[model samples]
Target: MANLCVAGGTGQVGRDVVRLALDAGHTVSVLSRHAPQAGSEKHHDGATYFAGDVTTGAGLEAAVAGADVVIDCLEGQFGKARKRFADGGVRLLEAADRAGVRKAVVLSIINCDRSTAAYYASKSAKERVYQESPLETVAVRATQFHSLPVAVFQAGAGVGLIPVFKGARFQPISPLDAAAAVLEAALEPGSSEDHRIRTVGGPEVLGMREMAVMWKSVTGARGRVVELPLPGAMGRYLRAGLNLAPGHAWGRETFVSWLEKRRETL
Candidate 1:
């Protein structure tokens, strides 16, 4: 096990990284705006929560001080997601380098091939940081989360209408699955200097409409089903090459299967 420092340890995907790293017997430092609440501390004995913000560079030197690897998942919302994703990571990289850390991995979105999509663009920019960096870097891009469809359907529940992308396809994975990959990559040395990317996707791909109906039925969300054709030919290709890697790694939970397990809980 390695000494691992995780930024954004409180975010959705970051939570999984903290949990998995701790469970794997690695010493963990989870950086958050504040310490974990009392209840949140019980599951991971290996995890130490450090109060820090990627933007401020607070508490980061200590967090990365003795770390063998740093996993960055910090992100922002809207166009802000892009800015913070780029700058926040550069800050962490500086801290890690100063601390003499060896391995670094960052979570990025797919097809962030440049500033194409606001979110993807930001991710792409951050990827560039690692490219120019001397530190060992790996950018593990994951598919849209398996939880997303459920989220979309749930948010639309109050409106009593579900919007479906008729021809759009999604190859989503559980956040845990994605997190596992980032962890694995952090430990495994690779060939590329920055190792620009990799993808972790579900066992199968499904149409967006079918996914919505399955979610609606399972969650018992009564809403009008408004099917919208794929957002344009481009929508079909939104993350066209992302969320997939035929032989890389497959998410244990399929889209509908994860929904089945989450339905009662949501």
Candidate 2:
């Protein structure tokens, strides 16, 4: 079994990746700022947790040492998100190289190249790092997670209103599906020098209005569904479906099914 390390394994998608990796029977290690203690998710899932910080290059060497594969699920946001991703990614790659890791798997957002949003721009830049570096890396760019729109709707409902972006389209896949894709990329057999990029998305593409309605129905959230035209270039890009991958609709879960399952846990 390969020794796999998951960076940022405590985050949303990272947690799924860690769980799936453990379930797949791989020896797993997770890097996080706070070391995981006994009875924690990592410990219970049979993963070794290492305290590391990618941005400052602290403890990363130990975290990735002797790892056969490294899956990067690191995330950054806001004005400094771009610099954090670019710099931290380079640092992580450098550490991986020192450890002689065989493969580097990176998770990114789909259609990041087509958007000017700060977060998307950072992710697009990070993808380039894998391409430019000599590390054998494969990037799986996935559509927004199904929880994204749900969160938006829930936040709006907190104030008794749902803001639907006019003309916006979303094809959100389950994080589990995205995690599977990342693991597949890491386990693919090939020369370690090969660099590949794949795109994955949900089975169906729906307008923001449609998704809002679905959220309302599934959660029984009563609120005003206010359709508003989003302003700025970011909004224009979203309205144009620049964040979707229609051709790579490999995700099988529908929003309705995801919502139903989600509500059952609430």
Top-TM-score structure, candidate number = 2
lDDT of 1 by residue, 1-266 (tens): 78988888878878888888877788888877777775664235557878887777888888888998899877776755556768888889999999999878988765666335566667778888987778888888877788766776677778898877555577888888888888888888645565557666766777778888888777788988787654533454543544355465467878777878877796
* lDDT tens digits by residue: candidate 2, 13-32: 78888888888798888988
Candidate 1: residue 122 lDDT (0-100): 73
Error of 1 at 208 (Å): 0.6
State, as a TM-score between 0 and 1, how close model 2 is to the true structure.
0.94
- lDDT values of the candidates? 0.76, 0.86
Clashes of 1: 1
Off by over 4 Å in 1: 41-43, 79-81, 190-192, 229-249
Give the C-alpha miss distance for residue 60 in model 2, angstroms. Answer: 0.7
TM-score of each: 0.89, 0.94
